[model samples]
Target chain A: MSAARVGVVTFPGTLDDQDAARAVRLVGAQAVPLWHADRDLKGVDAVFLPGGFSYGDYLRCGAISRFAPLMEEIVPAAKAGLPVIGTCNGFQILCEAHLLPGALTRNASLHYVCRDQRLRVEQTATAWTNTFAAGQEIVLPVKHGEGRYVADADTLAALEAGDHVVVRYLGGNPNGSLNDIAGIRNEAGNVVGLMPHPEHAVEELVGAPSTDGLGFFTSILKNLVNA
Target chain B: MARVIVDVMLKPEILDPQGQAIARALPRLGFSGVSSVRQGKRFEIELEGAADEAALAEVRKMAETLLANTVIEDYSVRVEG
Candidate 1:
């Protein structure tokens, strides 16, 4: 069988698409480049929305990118079970697009936080997290000015009840996200969004602290093969 | 041409740290007696024609779709000469 192919989307202001694609290639998967303006998804099995100041973070983080031509295709595909994972600014786009519930707001401290953050893996059933052990802790780099995750009471309750919280910040909440939510998955478990840059932590030689983030890429490849 | 103004503010339940920072600095600057402060955004859109109900409605849609994220904000639209 051929190697799995994953699409890495690049918007006008995207900065991490290259790193994301490198991570995909490191995992032995074909990394297909997807453009924000293009309507085609390139027949990739999964899509990765890398972190960066997309659209210069104009209007709001991820607000303008939500209407990108590629997003119009991705939104419906995600709803139909096309696996998708977004990190940082990409996570903001997911929220803005309503692919996932809730919204990411300014940090409670009103500062741009950039550091290695410890996160607890809360769910392993999702396509992107199946390689991780439940309750396992890992470190990933987080750098963003507006990474606070917020939701209404009922929505938070529902996410909790459905076991949709994929990961939670451990030790300390860097951005004051509600419930220390670092990552979340849809009910179907095919779509996931998180604030930390896993793509930046796939290798230790590049000073990533740890190679713990390679699991996310590997998990998707394995899942696509099985499917 | 007429102007359509849209004001977008965070929801009351959500925390506004930027506003809090300003509110905290106000007292130190000798400005007192203010209870609180909440920051928001205002956009003044110049319309090509009269600011009739139809034009106002279009601006409202723009506010809803772009100017404000209703998940954590509320917006008000009005017209001015």
Candidate 2:
């Protein structure tokens, strides 16, 4: 079987692009490096926006990066059903692009938090969480300052009504995200934005108790194979 | 030339940790009578012509689509001719 080509986009000041690529490769998929300035997607099956301080987070976290030329294509393509995963700052860009609803805000503590967080998979039917059973618990590293998730009441009700929330914080809510929402999927389930960095937890060599994040890379492969 | 200023702030219901931090620090400096403080963003736009209704209308659209996330923030545009 041919390996799935997963594109990991790297905007300037991106901190986790290479780690994301390594995660993809570790899952037996081909990692395609993508740049922010390029308008093309390089013919990859799926896209991954890694975490970082793109554009030096000048205006806001991801406020400037969302305007990158690549988003011109990535946004519409994602809307057209191309699967995409956005982690941390990438999640901010997703919301800033309006591909996903809600905005990530400053943590309740006004501090940059870094630690392994426990999350419960809410909807296992999505493009990313399909590898895990519904309600499965997993651990992934979350690192961010503006990690609080917020949306208007109507949007929040709609997201809840539609069951589009893909993951919720378990054990303890790290950044006071509204409803303890740690991750969410677009209505169509092709786009997912989460606060945790799943790519950083894909290897057992790191000596972590769980390689819980490996599911994300392999979960999307199913779509590649069936397509 | 005209100057357009837009002020963006979080909705009153939402928590403002950064603003809260500032408020706490103010008391330590012997400041009092401050009930609350909320932080926000300000964008100054320069228009080649007068800051007329047309420029104000356009800035409103920009504020909605980009300058502010209306889901969690409220913004107002003011024109200074």
Candidate 3:
């Protein structure tokens, strides 16, 4: 069978599109580069919104990018069960697009934080996380100024009820996310948004102590192969 | 003209470590009797030519649907002549 095509979107100021595409290729999938101005999804099997300061982080992290022409197509595609993953600024974009719940605000300390963060896989049922066992700890890079996730009580309850809380900070809460949540998945389990940068941690030589981030890419490939 | 004030916050049940950290620091800063602080964002929007109730409704819809997360926040709209 042919390899699954994973599109990594590149916004004007995106910094990690190449890393995400490389991660996809490392996991035996074809990585397609997508542009924010392009309206077509290019018939990719899945998509990844990689991290970066899109549009210079003006207005809000992902607020401007949500209106990108590509998102017009991506929103419906994602709703139709096309796998989608967002990291950092991409996560901010997903929330702005209303594809995910909550908003990412300035860090509680009001500073840009960059670190190798420890996160636990809270839910392994999502298309991007199926390779991980529940409660598995992984280290990934988190670099952002406004990474704090905020949502109302009912929404938080609903997410918990739906098992959409995908990843939680294992030790220190990096950006003051509620319940130590570092990532979340949509109700369909095909779309996920995460604050940490899994793409940055996919290689053992350059990444954390363990190359745990590759599982995210491999999980999507595995899902596509199984489907 | 109609003025809308939107306040966004994390749900009360969820822990606000930032708030907690600030609350804990207040005592050390020599600010006695400062009991607590919960941080949130406030948006003040003024609508022009939106004097009618219909216009007000439109602005409210915008706030509910995009400007704010209703799950953790409650917004109130005030109309002034």
Candidate 4:
């Protein structure tokens, strides 16, 4: 059987593309490097928008990056049910693209936060989180200056009711995200976005306390293979 | 040429940590009884012709779509003669 291919997009000033691709490779998948200017997605099964300060974080964190030519393809592809996952700035981009609900604003403490954090998997039915059990606790690294997740009250209510809130901060509300939401998925269960860097914890050899993030990659591969 | 000014600010319900930090600093600087401070963006656009209703509407579209994220922000546009 052929390996599942995951496309990792690299926007200008993106810092985590290499690590994201490496994480995919570590989980026995082929990592395809995608560029912001390139329109083609290279026929990958899934796409990942990695974390970084894209476009120098101007105007807003993910605001400029979403206008890249590649999004012309990604946005429609995501709507058509192609599995997509975004971490950190990638999460910000997903929101700016309107593929996912809500906006990520600056941290409530008004400072950049970087730490090994704990997260509770709240919805295991989403493509990126199927390998995790509901209420499962996992550790991942989070590093972002602007990570507060916000949305309208109705949207927040819908997400909770629809089982679209995929992850929540387990121990501490790191960034004052409303309802302690660390991640969420779209209505179709294909698109997922989170502020914590799961790719950073995919390999225990990289000084990650546990390889808990490997479940995210494995879960998607399983989903694609079954399809 | 006409100049249009656009002011973008976070909606009243959303929290503004940066603005709160600024408001806190004023008292330490010996300023007193200041209610609050909210920081926002101001964009001054120069157009090729004198401002008209059509031009103002177009600028409003830009503010709605790109210049401001309406999900969390509110924007106002005015012409500067």
Candidates in order, TM-scores: namely 0.98, 0.96, 0.81, 0.98
User: For every model in order, what is the number of clashing pairs?
Assistant: 0, 0, 2, 0
Candidate topping DockQ: 1
Candidate 4: docking tier: high
Residue pairs with backbone overlap in model 2: none
What digit string (tens of lDDT, one per residue) describes model 3 on residues B1-81? 566666666566645556878889898988889777776667777877665778778878876766655544555665644
DockQ of each: 0.87, 0.79, 0.21, 0.82
**DockQ score for candidate 2:** 0.79
Candidate 3 residue-wise lDDT, A104-216, digit = tens: 87677766898888888999999999999888988888898888888877888999888999998877887777778899999999999999988988888773656888999
User: What's the CA error at residue A59 for candidate 2, in Å?
Assistant: 1.7
TM-score of chain A of each: 0.99, 0.98, 0.98, 0.98
lDDT of 1 at A9: 99
Positional deviation of residue B28's Cα in model 3 after best superposition, in angstroms: 13
Q: How do the residues A25-135 of candidate 4 rate in per-residue lDDT, one tens digit apiece?
A: 988899999999999999999999999999999998888998999998999999999999999999999999999999999899998999989999999998899888889
- lDDT winner, 1 or 3: 1
**Ten-residue stretch with the least lDDT total in model 1 chain A:** A203-212
Q: Could you give the candidate ranking by lDDT, starting with the highest?
A: 1, 4, 2, 3
Give the CAPRI rating of model 1.
high
